[model samples]
Target chain A: MDDARRGAIEDFLRAASGDPALRITGAALLSGGAIQQNWALDVVLHGAPEAWVLRTDNAATLAVSLPRAAEYALLRAARAADVTVPEPLFLCKDPAIAGAPFFVMRRVAGIAAGHRVVKSATLGGGRDALARALGQELARIHSIKPPRADLGFLGAAPADAGLAFITAQRAALDRQSRPRPALEWGLRHMERTAPSPVPTRLTHNDFRTGNIMVDEAGITAVLDWEFAGWGDPAADLGWLCARCWRFGNVAQEAGGIGPREALYAGYGDVDDARVRWWELGAHIRWATIAIDQAERHISGVETSLELALTGHMVPELELQVLRMVETAHA
Target chain B: MHEPPDAANLLETARALLLAELLPALPEAQKMNARMIANAIAIAARAARDNSTFPTPPEADLIRAGAYDPGTPGHDAAVAMLMDIARARCAVSSPRALDD
Candidate 1:
């Protein structure tokens, strides 16, 4: 933490809390989130101590990500809907305050590493219950529909969300310098079998095991709302069940936490066919994103070993996509 | 000409030394990066040993152009070609993922 940024945060905290004596004890950067940066802050207001997290954009970010204000509003909406999200407190739009736009939210505790989360039998009420809780939490997130003034920036819900995704992916493929015949073929299959769009709802576009926070009791919070938008609810469900997101626990389909049935049971219903379709789409989406991450490293935009290795994951994801599409046709 | 130690052998020896000597000496924070370095070395060694080229099958362009339906002759062939390519990729990236 630099002096100028610390002074700005103190000023902002004083204003937000209306406490002239409020002081920040410490602030440390937290790990994870390749696209965003999170800072853990310790603060004392009128002798009452609290911990908060400051989330802001990194200098380099993905092309399709939402702005900080949008993400703040989404977090507020999710919290209001009884979803287990960190309570968003204040949004600081002035880049001078933190070198970028940012928001402060109450911090929650949990480990979210995919490898540990999948292997641990002691965290979050174990695998089956945790999977169910996630399903139920996703249901609550989906309950938040559009037509709100705050989330208006998300744009109108597409008439056919699946087809819209396919089209966007195809456009992305076109933008790539190298040809991707497998991806193109997968896109064609998706176009041919695109399901009729159901009623659109708020979807957490990146809901998976690693994005979720869990402790001994259960899920502490669902993190990462930057990709949340109005789309097919089934997209979230399928994304949760996608094999790539399973994180090596191939048998436990629901984010490598539990079976598909357990997840659907928590969600209160199951649309097996639609969920399967979106699972196929998930693989395609992941493959494209992996390539993008690799390009980010390769092109000198943001050089990172993790990003480069993520690019290597494309083949495994593509294989999954191919196998699923084959089974779908059969 | 280069001496008896080939590129693959050199990479393997370097990787062995890295894992056995330098990796354990690394702090906890740097362990993951050390492991990734070793993994990269292993991938390079495997790629060097298996030097077969993976050319995109001729049917790939036709598939991309929407020339064949699911049951058609070229369609299955294209899928097979893609599967083979995927397998080759897995051989270098994560051979274990293909084991199951």
Candidate 2:
């Protein structure tokens, strides 16, 4: 952050907090969130040190993501639903303060790296505990239903979440220059065996391990609300159990942290079939996202080798989906 | 025959040098980028060695239209063909994926 912007942010915080002497002690851009930039902030509020995160938009962002204000509303709703999330403080819509709209929230402490989280023996207390905690967190997230004015931006609940996802993925595939037969096969299988329409609830579209903050005791907070929407609650569980999110620890199943039963044990009784269906959807969604990321590079929107490499992940996801369909329990 | 040090071999040699000499000297922040570059080079080398191309299969539209649903005519055959294609792509893009 530049001195001028830092001074502007300090003035904004001072006005918002009603503390004349409030000062920003430190500010540093955090790594991660390809679509968003989070700046770790140290503030002196009321003569005490406060750790907070200022979240703002990146130079390039996916069209599907919610804006900062919408995300702030989501955090409030999730917090009200008893879901563990950072406490949203203030939202600055005026771009002059930081050259872009941003929001401030209390920074929760935990290690969130997917590879390290999956490989660690002690993080999240134990694998089982972490899995259960994740399940419980998801259950809390699902507890939030639609018809909420604050969450009205999510639009009406899908009549059939399965069909909605299938339609979306098909559209995404159609947008690609190359035809993906494997993804098509998976979509066809899903269409043939899609479960009956279920009541839609708030689904964290990206509730995998890496999105959560975890310490030795357990989960400290759930991160990333940009993709939350009214959909099948099982979608969250499926996303958690998706093979790609497991970071190569495929045997564990539940975010590569623990068994499915352990995760389910924390949440209430869940239909296994629905979770399986959404798990397939999760793979399709991930593959689509990878393609989209690569498109950003190919289209000359944002050129980066990371995005280019991500496109190569499509075949592996396709293979996973194919194997799942073939080995699906009768 | 052209030569022993072909494009694929040359790429492999360059990658080996990068890992041996350049990777260790890079800063921590740039290491991941270097590794990704190395991985991209490795993938390119494999692709050059294979010298294969994957055209979109005719079954894509059929599968999208649900002709590949279970018990449908040619469903199994189409699915098998897709699996073969996926495996072949993985061979060049990510061979370890096949093992998994």
Q: Which runs of model 1 end up more than 4 angstroms from their true locations?
A: B58-65
User: What is the iRMSD in Å for candidate 2?
Assistant: 1.2
User: Number of the top candidate by DockQ?
Assistant: 2
The local lDDT score (0 to 100) that residue A328 gets in candidate 2 is 78
Clash pairs (backbone) in predicted model 2: none
What would the per-residue lDDT of candidate 1 be over residues A1-330, giving only the tens digit for each residue?
Answer: 798899898899899888998999999999858899999999998889999998998899998899899999999899889999999989999998889999999999989999999998778897789988998999999899877898998999888888889888887777777877777778778878878889899999999989999999999999998888889999999998998899889899899988888899999877888998899889889888889889999999998888888888887887778788788788
| lDDT of every predicted structure (CA atoms) | 0.87, 0.90
> Per-residue lDDT for A236-295 in model 2, tens only?
999999888999888898999888888999898799989989899899899999999999
Error of 2 at A313 (Å): 0.2
